[model samples]
Target: MKILTAVCVMALLVIASAAWADAPKRVKFTWSGGEAVAELNGSPSAESLWAMLPVTVDFKDFNGVERIAYTEKELSAEGAPESCTPDAGTLALYAPWGNLSVFYKPFRESRGLVPLGRFVEGADKVSTLGEAVRIERME
Candidate 1:
């Protein structure tokens, strides 16, 4: 009886592991020479950005502290209020210009800025990302 119970538990564990492996993945960014994983924070603006995945844009150094890219695709700013300034390695949407900002250095708060997802990997190298970046869902 004990052996049968052990086998049943092992089978359940295997099933659970398979389910987890097949779960939907987060987003990722890939460039010519590097890649980074990102996780969203459940904001509507972030959702809008996620909806428009598989996008490619050229990133350029902006304001001497952040890397900015023009997506040309507008994202919803609803439910995201103007809050405190974002820290380094934060990804935000500059609503005023309708562009995406990947901050490599700290900056003061500004209106029309919405919080998006942040790079989980390769964040420290954000400032060094070269031109032509592709954003897409992992799977």
Candidate 2:
């Protein structure tokens, strides 16, 4: 009886982990230059951003490395990591300033930056985006 119970618990755990692994939501970003798809992780900040999707914002080149834009409001950062080392194609939020940042170049670890997602396509095109950009969920 104990062995059967243990097996059932392990099976449940495996199923739960699988569900969590597939929880990330995919979103698309489109601008005059091009478009890209990002896979957002399962964090409160990411969820907040996802909920506010279908949003249009203006983006600007920043520090010769990333494209930065301000969301309509700050996202929930309750469960976000303290810091992150962003690489090319990383999508993140600057918690303090409530701005979204898409990195086209590798960057050192920084604090108060919540990782939202990573671009799965056309990451290079981010650098060429014009001022107006649209973000929306992909089905």
Every model's TM-score:
0.78, 0.82
lDDT of 2 by residue, 9-120 (tens): 9999999989866876899999888899999987889889999988999988888888889988778889788999999999999898888999999888989888998999
Q: What stretches of model 2 exceed 4 Å from their correct place?
A: 1-23
How far in Å is the alpha carbon of 46 misplaced in model 2?
Answer: 0.6
Q: Model 2 lDDT vs. the true structure?
A: 0.88
Model 1, 4-97: lDDT tens per residue?
9999999999999999665534677788768877777768988898889889889999898888898868888888887648788788899888
Top TM-score hit = 2
lDDT for position 55 in model 1: 91
Q: What is the C-alpha RMSD of each candidate to the true structure, in Å?
A: 4.2, 5.5
In candidate 2, which residue pairs get closer than 3 Å at backbone N, Cα or C atoms, i.e. clash?
none
Give the Cα lDDT of each candidate.
0.82, 0.88
Q: Lowest summed lDDT over 10 consecutive residues: which window, candidate 1?
A: 20-29
